[model samples]
Target: MRAGHCAPGWNVTSMKDIEHPIPVRIAYVGGGSLNWAPTLMADLAHDTRLDAEVRLYDLDPAAAERNARMGGRYAEVSNGTPARYRAVPSPREALEGADVVVVSILPGRFDDMAQDIGIPARYGIPQAVGDTVGPGGFVRAMRAIPMLAEIARAIGEHAPNAWVCNLTNPMSVLTGALHAAFPGIRAWGECHEVTKIRRQVAGIANADAGSDRWSFRDVEVNVLGINHFTFVDAISLGGRDMLPAYRAFAAANASGVNETVPGEDAEHDRYFGSKCLVKFDLYDRFGIPGAAGDRHLAEFLPVGDYLADPGRWGFGLTPVEYRTRDQARRRARAEALAAGEIAPVAKRSDEALIDQIVALAGGGTFVSNVNLPNRGQLAGIPEGAIVETNALFSGLGITPLVAGHLPEGLHDIIADHAARQSALLQAVMAGEGGALFPLFHEDPLVRHMPETEARRMFGEMIAATSAWLPENLKGAA
Candidate 1:
């Protein structure tokens, strides 16, 4: 046999020969509908180490067919390797023998959520307030948790050894549900927030783009608390603390911070206007970079800030507005497709972080980030608490880094939040409502509500979500 090549039924000459030779079967749950699927499929097709078979599962048959067709096109265009593509509605059929499962489901659909927020706004509650901190996030979480649990259960039965990666909102909450309910399964939740923050920090530092001198390594990001609520406690460049520079940058541009990059007229500034001021304020007070953008950060604050005089918060739109805009864009794209004005689909450059992990695992190097517990990867968080941290992957398997003791204040906050998330997950898994009230109270934004209003909002929010919640949580007053 040639070096670096393994033949079937090899003679017992070396230790490597006895290792498994089966091609890793990777399945993507909810992969068909996402705009990012084509690029991801292309990446998977190009990776030579593993004999990759990409299976795409979605409830929508047309969408699934569209995704598979795109994947086939990419294989021919990129690698000349014809990869297998399967579209199946059954989770078991899609997940069977899979080494990795990527999930990105939009349960309740964007349209339903637009209505959820819009209908509530008509009743005087701000629509965006519901998604991040108030009724919206809670109800969205309620609707999503059950579906995630169902996926977990299906993965448990069909793909017992596969690693599951969740890319959904209320990330920590959903990951927590999988951790509590499916003990044996390996899973993690990922979002673009941390990566986005890193990019912003780089731009703030005025680093050269093509040089290896500046990268995510140059910055030390201390992201504590839940996904969107994370704050960058410290940032450093070239082994020197750079918080002062960041502060100065914010101050100098306070009047009209043009976050737009130079020489890029077409580039829309990702962070701009009043939200930049809010980001500055957060940096000043917390000494940490805000992970989410100004729009999301705005929602976490008191609704009165924006609603004080109705329409005073200039250019600031609620989550429903964001959703509405996204829906319109999606509709336009669909119409373009119908009219043959646009190509069947276009490949996205950005790939889900999970796909990278799977590729690395096929090789023998491990990388770690926030993932659910698989041993003692996280020290202080309870055995199964979903933690965000670095991880390592290799032929040996995935291992999360053991984040040592966190600050007492941060620990307490994380623990409290984790408890509520855990309880909610448990409630969904066992179909119990006992944990709902405690979960609501644990929310940081809910802490700001008056006791009377908190109770009222809690009841009303639960009532609104009752139709979609587990049977046990439904009809509960």
Candidate 2:
């Protein structure tokens, strides 16, 4: 099995002579040289049932090539799956014939984020936060929506059958844009957050990591509202109520190793510890931990609660800052690898749970946290509005679970947030700049401020994001 470009007419029938017959062609956009794509490819290649060919595209051709080489090396050393890699600067070229198009692009990356935060802070709006909340999320959505629309258009034109797995922030907005714009396209946003949360719960429950004790299988957890503002309405294990144990864990500050995640760093620290304040609050009131935390939680809480005191809660860096710092560190490390001063990060082979869903989709069983039309998935949400919940996938197709009526309190809060976010996505898709003001005004962090101040901060943040936002938004700013 050769690596790199493949000759034409290498049909599955001809390939069957070798061993594995059906090759799953995956196209990845952005973070091509990052760990996820290569690691995922390596895992897929090892499966005797999968013949995986990865076509990686990025704005930076060199980065794409580097990623492809590393991915090729991973396949060769590990499973010896006939893996082929390509670096196409053109998104259309990379997207052609892709069974799955994985999107992880950050349009302006972090430099633009710094401006979104710094400029707003200058106006005394005090936004150490960005990404999931505030004017920053609005601006970020504006910049990203167009690109995602373009990606969706490309998929529709070039590979109508491809499943788009979006791994971008503001996941709800982007996924909603795709759903609204290309109704025929099969797309869903992917986030590791829910999986991480499930693992945390298992740890809190003192379930063994090695067994099915805490496996996500058959565990019913309801996530509502937008991406980051989601809350767990119900969680049950083996038809037994588990919310009591989860609430106890949240309240008691139980310290147990999280069995699902594989690291112990600042990321893990924040994951396990930092969001306790909100979880504590939610448990006391709602009897369960809020699925979204930190900036996400701040965005959903009443504005008064968020604006009361940043000192006591401590403001944190925005998503752009966090992502930028991480990327810079990764680039610095990659530079060492390029100079042969450091060995390439050793590739690991762990099957992504998402990939399992994809495999199931191919085989006819599709289970995931999909962002798609409500169509009665949740009793209270608008029928066509996007809702994230457990979905059953089989050969027939994807079926989102209809979450029966939620608790009235939770339903009201989630419905409010969902309406705001859905409107934001619609505004972006329509390129309506004025709609941004309302979205910002609706945000929990800004709702408490006077109308004049809220508008002023919104204007200021838009100005800061001028460099990255769409031309219409720039003009509005």
Candidate 3:
């Protein structure tokens, strides 16, 4: 078969075919992102396979311009070809006739994010990484959903055929809001949590973490549930069932190997300390392997216990200083690249976004976890709710692989939360102030507290973020 040819659900194409590939037009919604923008540029450069015309759009025009210049320099200095890069002023200009749209925006900066974390802390709710779930996610949804809705409307008007790929945090909520705003829009959320879990599972099989020692193409793992709180029910390696061995390893931490993920170098000293223990604990207690980092997993636990001793869960309150330092590092790297003092490096990333685009646009098949509307892939979760599950991307379109059922306890937990997320989106969209309180009340962290306390906390958070929130939600307290 030819490079762009595939057999129904099977895709057997090689990189050699990508030598002279079709050109894909990509529009980046938050192109100024210092954190993700550079890595994405490097990935596109290394692919060297598929050609692309890239449009950079950002609220900060200067940042987008800098990225465009950086990409141009990278293309000039690199050994292989990269996408054609340009910075456009408006989202409409960027989205016009584009093939794919990538969204990676921080709706508000660190000061706003600080309110998402800090205000909730006053009410005795402690969040390790407040970007995803809990009080932090709820308030963030308030500020981000409206902005994302506008972006979705623009995509609908300017580039209806474009595939919307969101890499924003509060992953499930943000992605859900997009679909809620623009139903029938082709979209999905890409997260690195499952990829990290896959690497750890691969390490357990004695497979090289960074190599194709065991190809991802040869393995099948049933990943289901919400983003960051996902669970893997089964894993098959090379047509052999490795679930038992994996389960044993999870129960015993038998690998005894440091997973060595990014941002984990500071805690590299502890044996099982640097590693993920809460995930293993979930597998032992719930019979479903936890698939995200412990930092994320800790969010779903009761607030008081985690607040009492966060170190037990392998995380701490992520200070704003960390964000400041990260921004400085990105700025320094950009300055060095522009000054021609340091050469641009092109390396393949574990991020499957590029692979997904190539597979969908180039007529190949790629299997990976994606967040999309649930259409029977996971049992017990509402059918239309956005879910994270194993999906096959190809010319046939993105198809979810059916994951039969989650353990009853885990299913109940996920189903309840998924439903709440769905309801929360609706309430936020409709500006229904009364409906918002119960959603926060039901949150895993705040649920243990009295309804009055939850209400007070919700009101305080809303007030703290009044400058960015909707009129109905701003002072609903």
Per-prediction TM-score to the true structure, in the order listed: 0.77, 0.83, 0.91
Off by over 4 Å in 3: 1-16, 77-79, 207-212, 215-219, 254-257, 262-274, 304-307
lDDT values, one for every candidate? 0.57, 0.62, 0.76
Stretches of candidate 1 off by over 4 Å are 1-24, 42-51, 79-83, 119-133, 207-222, 234-244, 255-274, 298-315, 318-325, 331-355, 358-360, 364-368, 371-383, 402-415, 447-465
Model 2 agreement with the true structure over 1-477: per-residue lDDT tens digits? 110011111101111223444567778888355646655655655545556677888888888877776665555544445567777878888888888788878757577777666665665455535665566666787888888888888888888888777777677778877877788988776655555455566554555345545554334466655577666666655546677877666656633322323554666344233434554565566654666554456655664565345434533434455666667776665555445565433343333433443444453243445666677777788766667765554444565665466566777877876787788888877778876787777776667778888777777667666766677777553
**Total clashing pairs for each candidate:** 16, 6, 0
**Which candidate should be chosen as best, given lDDT against the real structure?**
3
* Residues 119-211 of candidate 1: C-alpha lDDT, one tens digit per residue: 446545564434444456766788888888888888888998887778776777787766665768777776555554555566666543454
Clashing pairs in 3: none
Task: Rank the models by lDDT, top first.
Answer: 3, 2, 1
The predicted structure with the larger lDDT, 1 or 2, is 2
Ten consecutive residues with minimal summed lDDT in candidate 1?
3-12
lDDT of 3 at 145: 85
Q: What lDDT does candidate 3 reach at residue 405?
A: 79
lDDT (10s digit) by residue, model 3, range 97-131 = 99999999997778878888888888878777788
